[model samples]
Target: MENQVTQLLKAMVKPDYTACSYAFMQDGKIVCADAIGVIDKINNQPITTDCTFNVCSISKIYCTVCVMQLVDEGLIQLEDKVA
Candidate 1:
């Protein structure tokens, strides 16, 4: 499975791409973690699974889901101010 995933990533990597990282988890435990390509294209620094990424809009979706969960639990009101 990991070999297949790596092959897929290698195929997807383009000349313009710097790096890619992936993790697969089951039951809250990581089953596979891999990183490919360079962290700094200029310096040629390699990336690792431990590298941090700015996940942008995905964070907003996570926050919205968390707020919705709180509303479902009657811990927060939808009309309430976030601050």
Candidate 2:
């Protein structure tokens, strides 16, 4: 079942988004958790579980705050390329 979940994540990559992380639960417990695809096309870094993603509208605030903090620090610029 874990292998199937992993394969699905791999198959779902590209064409739309380059990478995704997934967790499948069974009976209120996590049965499978993993990530697939390169972090970006340029660096080709593998997406790790430690990385955070704003996957839905409910997550926008957290991502927005992180981005805004980066902007304030000038670590990320308006001209920066985002993946």
Highest TM-score scorer? 1
Spell out the clash pairs found in candidate 1. Answer: none
Cα lDDT tens digits, model 2, 37-78, are: 877768877888777876688578888899999999989987
Clashes of each: 0, 0
TM-score of each: 0.72, 0.54
Please give the lDDT score for candidate 1: 0.92
On the 0 to 100 scale, the lDDT of residue 54 in model 2 is 61
**Reference-based lDDT, each prediction:** 0.92, 0.81
User: Which one wins on lDDT?
Assistant: 1
Clashing pairs in 2: none
lDDT at position 73, candidate 2: 98
TM-score of predicted structure 2:
0.54
lDDT, candidate 1, at 66: 96
